[model samples]
Target chain A: MGNRSKDLLQVEHSHPSSSRESSLLVGKNDSKPLQQKSYLQGNPITVPFPKSEVLGKVKDFIGVISEANRNLRLYAKDKPEEYDIEVLTGNESEYIKMDLMLGIADLHTPESLAAAEAAIAGCQSVINRNSTSSSLEFEGSSEEEEDEEEDDGGEDDDTRQSGSHVRHKDSELQQDDFLSALLRSHQKKKPSKIIELSVQSGSDCSIRSMAMATLRREGKRLSPLISPRPIEALRSALVPYQEEAHGLRYISTQAVRNRMKSVKSIQKITKAMKMVAASKLRQVQSKAENSRGIWQPFTALLGDIPSVDVKKTVLVTISSDKGLCGGINSTSVKISRAIHKLNSGPDKEAKYVILGEKAKVQLVRDSKKHIELSITELQKNPLNYTQVSVLADDILKNVQFDALRIVFNKFNSVVSFVPTMATILSPEIVEREAEAGGKLGALDSYEIEGGETKSEILQNLAEFQFSCVLFNAVLENACSEQGARMSAMDSSSRNAGEMLDRLTLTYNRTRQASITTELIEIISGASALEG
Target chain B: MSSSAAVPFWRAAGMTYITYSNICASLVRNCLKEPYKSEAIAREKVHYSISKWSDGKSEKPTIRSDVAED
Candidate 1:
């Protein structure tokens, strides 16, 4: 079995490899000799070359210089006692030249090289004074030699213990020097840090003045580089304060007054809006109650009919165009989306007929392809049967559908409403049921005149039903919108009142604090005069 | 009995009456002829009711009735 398996594997592998070898041989036969002959006859042959080689070399050169500069900077920072400025500057120049010869040195600009040298020089001098004061004996030791000596000493216990006492004293002095050098370098690197420290300390006026003078000098020198001066940055940051010492008190009072005025005005507007919405809610609620008679029975009838095999359905979503109606519009939109999701399949096509601007704006963002028609400005005035009839007629004439589903917010109470959906069967479905004498048995019993066919009568009935249902849905939605708006405005007014209370409390406390400070100043002045 | 009593009488009767009225009204309107028929059709085509609150100007609400006047 093992031999047979090996034979099968060999056959499978050999078939592709042998075919690949034959193809390679054919490929060579056609062009290999011609290419070699061209090369021999001194004719140029085209060959693809990668374009990134030059860029790659430039990047590598930059990387090497940056890495060397980083290492040298770290050495200068960590072990200032072992640093020799003159030797370091000389080695840096030589290393750079060697790297240039090796095709890796691209730091050719004078300014950058000068900057590197200046940074090294600055770092060297920072620790030079401290190192010279303490480590005069080890001053001439190279960095690598010192490291090697330390490493070798670590290997032998006798030598290590003998050197520990001297090393400890040296290290103590080195720590002080290193800390001072670090502070100096940090001050130079970020002048702002020193200025902030001086300002925060506040006890030493002489030091702050000196720091300011040095920052001014550095700012002048680095002006071409656009480095922000510490003094200038501080001045800009404190620009809201006046130059005069007493101006701060007057500015605080004026800012407080302005804030109080704006908050008061906002509170007034929200209070007025809340009152208006509350008054309007009553009328809208009554209208919604009256319209319940129109839609409730139709919905009941619709519920009795069994679900049909509908290919196309029209979804009519009712909402108000205005905002600040809480989540009424979003509720209708969510219901429509869920219904659309349920009806979505390969064979089912759902088209949208939106009634208000709010739902149109939302559905258009995501389901623009399904929106067949959108009717706006319906909420500018209160909805009535006449407007809805015209809307229904327009929808009926424009689109063909087997069923129509209406989505609207149903007013349950003044504070709450539910997003509801109701369906209306098309005339064709009613006629089919009548013919079959099955689901819509009650609809089949209705008598028609001699001139009108059963289907035409059913069509007229459906159109009338659609208008009535749309009118009811719009009324209910409008009522819900008003109720929601009233509650939302009430809550906003309450929140604004709370905010006003907090602001007034803050304003009064600030006033009292300023008053107390002035009184204390006067009392101190009086006591000093008496003394 | 209390739940049934809670429902208003007009609500129970109004739905059937309106549905029947609408069907009858459309059928009767369909039998009319000439200018009267055209006027009735136009009137039935668009309906407008007065809003409770006037939005500044007392102008009637704008209507987009493009039902072919035929």
Candidate 2:
């Protein structure tokens, strides 16, 4: 390729007529050329010529030529030989004029258009969004150029094509710098037309592309001398497709990064909740250690029974105040609903004494009429004998019933809990049972002490037993809540981790793909410029 | 009708056994250690903020220990 360029330069130096012949030979001579980088390492490699600086230099040169032509046009009409010189110089002027048009066309051609758009891409997101369409136009134009003045294929192309087209008219230097009017009249007509079109289409993109396409098509048609060498055409066609793939890659990298960030934050939250729940479970389980036997007195006096035939029954539900414990509140609510259904009838009446906001909200929706006394926030503070005693006294004063059942969740392990109910009988019911000689009637066999009346002693014991049973129930329910919450948060954190893994994989693959596309663009571009 | 031990002071003062047991439970709950003690004391400490709506807007609530004393 280097030798061929040297051969073309020699032809340009010899005579204007043989330059066409040499360009044809270079086009046809692509047989079995030596393919080595060593062949191209020499002085024949000229500076890449289609740069904006080079274009400016060429324009400055044209300005001088046009000035000289204007002066010579006054004297050339009288002499025939000088007229021929004028015509031939006119032809050289056309070559330079074509150079000026390609310079302008170089700025407007699809590749340069894409570069300009890319320069503004940071500010104009609207423009970047339409990159695919603009890329289609780039390939359609097949204007082989890399990033402005930096990469070589198009600059090298402009240099080689302009070198062949602008052969010095008379190599003998006789008609060379003559103030002859070479194509001065013809160049004026076309550029004036182009300048008019450029002005009209400056601000609007659609009009600008239309004008540029027209200029390129007409410049090739009108001045057949300004033609691109045929070999450059085959290589220029593939540049835009390579760029198209890169454009697609650049679009979605940001979206993938955003998804990765959100998933990571969610994982952080769930992990913190899991840790909090574990610590809470430990504390509550320790407090619940001595709460088991407080219900023994009520059991001994009442015996194991569900109070199936009681006329008036009160079901006391112990649930946690706060939520996010999985299935703890719901399981208790379901059991309470079943017991409520069993205890409802025309002659029999049942009431709910709900403890805790979670179960109260559920029960309110189902049986708002049956709820007698609902107390909440019992678990917000630590449970103790005094609080339970006060609360049990309040319940006893607020509602009148024959049988009272305290329902709560009993914690067995970290992963298991049982819905349990401890039943307590009213004093009147206890006294009747003693008269009827049931298992609880054995209480009469012992000597009771320290009360003005026997019935008052029974009431004292009942109230004390109620407070103890309530304290135990509240502690057990708290332990269960903490255990359920620990497991729930643990699973949430695990699911977040899984989602993050999938997103990170996608993020890595996309980043790698974008990098490879850029490398392919640079290497393919370098080879195309070589061609 | 029964052999019995001597009555406690609250019962001798004509208070019911229910009131006596509650007083004992309260005293025991107040003697707990650290975190449990603080919460239990706070639970038993009741303060009423009494407010009166005269003509239009209600007056600022005033802390009243008299209600719990009664």
Candidate 3:
């Protein structure tokens, strides 16, 4: 209490001389500057906060101020270093992708083709350079001379030809005669040719299932054409090229498979797009037709109302709850806003009954203090007459309005959509205008006398118009909703197809690289084998 | 099951004698422990006498009277 009184007395003393201003002194240990110091020295007490906590708060505030800047810097500083590494790696990968594609093309084109041509030339040159030595062995003149001598000796010996018919007992005598003749021929012939003659006669004669004849016929027909040397060389040269061709074929098959997948995906997308467009077009047309049927009777009845001054108007704006159908809801909202703006006067007033969420959101901002009475989850099912009439009765009973208008997307055709406003409460002025323009052809045709009375007829007309307008609103909304859905699905399918196409292109490029490498190795190997 | 009827006489006798002798030896070995050398030998003799007749031989051995009675 003493301290409080002392502090109050100091404040009172300092209040008289306001120029001095350092009055609330509690303790010298206080780090905070006095509030009176703010008045005296004009230096505010600035609290120094922890840098890390302050920076965190600043970052939070910056995120609210500009999300794009904060996100970009945060991603750069805090994200994995692999992102930059990936960027560099992606460049390298792209180079590899290009090289791979080019390699495949080169394998089919100048590089591999040149290599194949060179290999073929080398093979042909080898054959040409070897032709001299090869021809010497091929002509085999000395061998032929020996062969001729053998043939002459074989022709003179009837024993050699007739031994095939030798019976079991006489075969021994025939064999003795054959050996004596062979000896006589060997003595008569040239010494070098004698051996060949014996070999030829023995080979020409069948063994008659005797092992002795086979033994005598051995080592005949030994020439260069039948030699294993050339065959061995040809086989060794052929192996590498054949292996290369097989590798190329495998790579080409994979490339073709990848391309086929992309082609199939494109075909699927195109087919799906056509289906969606066709279905949406049909649905939109049908809904338009049904709505048209509803609107015709409504318009006719609207021509019967007697009111002219639209001092107070009730606008019922209908739009699709879902957006994606080009500009249907936007135009409906725009037309509703225009009507509201035109009716805002001292005497004139405009009220709104929103049918869809999209239109309600738009109109809610403009209408000050006049909130919309929105019925939630009412548009999913078909519109019932009882519900529609209840709405109509509520509007008619609670609100005193001169004009009632409906703003909705009117489907003129499959391609043509328009925002249309039709008056339901005041039809006489519209009818007068139609008459003035020489269009009084349909009013007298609908008039029935004395069965109910003119006033009763007018009341019935009002009820019918209300039903028609409500039905039209629901049908148009359904059509617009379906149209939006179809287009959205179509674009989604197209995007997926495009992604598949790009992946296939990448796959082809990689496959091409592998094929090119195989081709190079094959050419080098074949050349090595040939040399 | 009756393949023994087709087997040679010597082979069948040998197989039957080996099987019976193995079974009798294992049963006596499991019952007797080390350090009872004389008693173990007597037990083995008794087991062999009991099982000897089970062998399918041309001249079959008879079981000892004491074992048969037991």
Candidate 4:
């Protein structure tokens, strides 16, 4: 509290306009109706949520004045830190009541996002406005935050979870990032021009949304702005947020007789999805096609190990999560079963890590015992390295094996999709193979330009290579799946066209026979009447 | 400079890999020869209807179901 008060005085003295501007920005960004209404004197506070959130500016101005008063009083006191701790205790109690008032589970997400967004823009401007003092203040806050986090975290197990404390640290780090970025961005501006600070939170790509859906959940507290950030890097960090693939199980063949008009409409939707879907397949396919591309060397280095001394083997079968994709899943399942038969015996153990729902439904009936891990809804999104890498990590964690054999449909042109297997040796096996000197083949030098022990480098290389191989295998399988579906749908649509013609012919024939019968009856009746 | 780091940061957190690769794939997809791309897309120019799998079970002529058949 004392530090905040001190900082406020320093900022107000340095730049008079900033104190007003800080409150204005906060008010504008407050999507949450945090009025901080006067319920202070040990009384239960009612929910003061006015229906109109337009009162943000009014409430925020009042909040700033109160903040300024509190800070000023604390600055006057000898021990500001002790007074601030009391303020924290008071706020924490009120926040507990506020949590109860906000009934919705995800209410905090948006509120936090807004707070973080404002913090980013606000902190950046503060650093830009007064450079030297802000940096010092930043270090102080960071040190305090770290200390607070250490106090929060004593349990070793809970650290595995990127807990609430870590997120607080992340937000502080984010402020540091903004400070650095603004230092660079501000340098380009005219010296005399005042830097305008407007918070842009609505942009989904902005740090607001990204903060909530961070890769921290994966136990990797990576800085968002360490280097050039490709937005897709964090794509997997976001929950798949897609319709579950299992829902497709309920949808059967077209129930309505698809008229010419209906067929055209269906084609339009398919076309829109396909334009994107096909190109993705084509890109992955192109990479696979290339004989001497830059990625080719990487692919080859990490590519198929023809034979590994199979003691305990894991067959990771790649198949589509959704049904109606024809034989994309079936062929892979067939090969998976065959490998299981080949590798499984008295001494050797082979486990199945099925990667789709379609195969799981089939394999569960027969080889339920060998199945270690089954992941579905994977094909709901396109394949990416980070997602696949995470998946590889998960698979490795669950199953300890000598050889990791990946069975996926290798795309060979439009019609031919071969159910192929790519084997990646475990790190220990790789080290063993290196000692025996089988197929090191100048590949080791290319992949890991070594300074460390050869074995240590190989261990890291093996894990990384598994991710790459798995990533490629998934892409190849996806391309094959798309091609297989296109051909299957093409033939089925043709069959439907022919069936429509046949049905129409039958209808016409029945109509003609009925008309002929009616005409005969009419003629007989007329002849009888004349006689 | 040789990247001494064992795994790319994207491999861990902050989406270094998924975004980078998805972007790369999209870029490659865009670079395809124009004629072949347009031709195939045009071939799929027309194809709609609701209530799938309803036909295999429905014996009645679809002429009277919902929308007035033309």
**Candidate 3 true-interface contact recovery:** 0.00
On TM-score, the stronger of 1 and 3 is 1
Candidate scoring better on lDDT of 1 and 4: 1
Summarize candidate 3's per-residue lDDT along B1-70 as a digit string, tens digits. Answer: 2433323443345432223333445576667666675454433322111111111211232222223333
Candidate 1: list runs displaced more than 4 Å.
Answer: A1-251, A297-309, A433-439, A445-451, B1-70
Q: What TM-score quantifies how close candidate 4 is to the native fold?
A: 0.43
Q: Give fnat, all candidates.
A: 0.08, 0.13, 0.00, 0.00
Count of steric clashes across candidates, in order: 1, 4, 0, 16
Q: Residue A420, candidate 4: how far off, in angstroms?
A: 0.6
Q: Write the per-residue lDDT of candidate 2 for residues A405-447, one digit (tens) a residue.
A: 8888999998899998877777788888788876777878878
Per-residue CA lDDT of model 1 for A162-250, tens digit only, reads: 32222222222222122222223233233143333322232222332334233333333333443223333333434444345447554
| Top candidate, metric lDDT | 2
In order of appearance, the predictions have TM-scores of: 0.52, 0.53, 0.36, 0.43
| Candidate 2 local Cα displacement, residue A341, angstroms | 0.8
A best-first ranking of the candidates according to their lDDT comes to: 2, 1, 4, 3
Sorted by TM-score, highest first, which candidate order results?
2, 1, 4, 3
What would the per-residue lDDT of candidate 4 be over residues A56-95, giving only the tens digit for each residue? Answer: 3323533454465456555748676654432464445321
Interface RMSD after interface superposition, each candidate: 15.0, 8.7, 54.5, 13.7
Candidate whose TM-score is highest: 2
Q: What is the TM-score of chain B alone in each candidate?
A: 0.41, 0.47, 0.26, 0.30
Candidate 4 error regions (>4 Å): A1-295, A441-450, B1-70
